[model samples]
Target: MNEQLQSITGVILAGGQSRRMGRNKATLTVQQQSLLEIMLNKLRSVFQHVVLSGSQAAAYHTGLPVIDDFFPGCGPLAGIHAALKLCAGRGVFVIGCDMPLVPPELIRYICNCSNFDLVVPRVGDYLEPLCAFYHRSCLPFIEQALNQGRYKITSFFPRVRARYLTAEEISRFAPPDRAFFNINTPADWDRFCALYPDLKA
Candidate 1:
C-alpha cells in the first residue's frame, strides 16, 4: 500500500445498478464493512486521494466527495469519464466495485507504468478496462466516443496510447485468470466465498 501511494489518485467506480446481484453490491458486506467501504479503505492506503465515482447521494455522506458520470446509463465508460473529469491529478487509477480481492501490489505496478495513456491487464483476450489507469490525455478521445454514442469502454483505446498486460506479465502477481475475478451473481459470490474462506467473515 505504501508503495502504491507514491503517486496515484484512486477512483472507485460504484455507479452500476447491480441488476445481476439483485442488490447494491457496493453495500454488500465482507467482514462487516460495506464493499464500498472496504474498497475505499484499501485505496486510501495507496492513493494520494480517493474519490467515489457514482450518483448515489447517500455515498457523499461517507465524507468522501462523489463525482457522477457526465453522461448516465453508458456503463463503465461513464465512470471513466467521471473519474477523468473530477480527478485532481493528471492520472487516475480506476477500480470496480465488486473486485474485493484486487491486490494492491498489482495496482501499484500498473500505476508506476509510465508513458501510457492507459494501462490494462488482459484476461484471455479480453481487456480488463474497469481495473486500470487512464491519463488526462485520453479525455478528448473519451468525449468524442461519448458524443458519437460509442460508449464501449475500449472504444477510445485505438485513438490513444495503451499498455496491455499479458497473461505471463500478470502471473507474477496472481494466477493468470483468477486475478481478475469478481462477484456478479449469487452463484459467483458463493464460489468466491468457498474459494476465499475468509470472505465469509
Candidate 2:
C-alpha cells in the first residue's frame, strides 16, 4: 500500500434495500466467501482503517465499525455523508458492496488522484460515484444537496473540485465492462458466476 493511501479510510456502503436481488447482497457468496468479505479484504489490504456503512446487524457479522445513515432513506448520499463524518478529516474510499469485481488497482489509482474534493471514474458517459474517493471537504456540499432533496450522488459535483478518471485510464486496471460490474439482481449474480466459475471453488 502506498503511504498516502494508508491515511485514507475505506468505507463499504452496504445500506441498499436490495429489492431487485430479494436478499442481502452482502451475504451472497463468491468462492465460498461472502461479497462483504471479499470487499472488506480488498479494502483492508489498501487501507488501515476500514469501516462498513450499513445496519447494526451487518456490523455484528463483519466485526468492523459500522455506521448507519445520518439521513435514513435518502439513498447513497446519506451513506456518503455518514462515512465522511465518521472519518473526521481523513479521506474515504467509498464503494458499493454489490460491486464484487471492483479492482483494487483502480481504487489505488483513484486515491492517487486525491488532489480534488472528489475523485470519481468517468467510464464512458457514466460517472461511477459509488466507486470513488471523497475528501472531508465535500461534506458541506453533500449536506447542502441532501437538505434540498437532491439525492443524486453527483448533484454536489459542481460545488466541489472534482476529478474524473477517463475510460482509457480505467482500462489499464480492468476492462471497462468488468471493472464496475455490480450484482443488482439474481440474473446478474448468475451471470457473474458463469463468467468466473472458479469462484465457486
Which candidate tops lDDT?
2
- How far does residue 91 in candidate 2 sit from its true spot (Å)? 1.4
Candidate 1's displacement at residue 29, Å, is 1.4
TM-score of model 1 (CA atoms) = 0.91
| 13-101: candidate 1 lDDT, tens digit per residue | 88788899998888877667777877787788678788888787345377877888889888788888878877766678899878877
lDDT of each: 0.79, 0.86
Candidate 2: worst 10 consecutive residues by lDDT? Answer: 54-63
| Candidate 2 residue-wise lDDT, 33-86, digit = tens | 888888988898778889889664364477788888889999899999999987
In candidate 2, which residue ranges exceed 4 Å CA deviation? 56-60, 199-201
Top-TM-score candidate index: 2
Stretch of 10 with least lDDT, candidate 1: 1-10
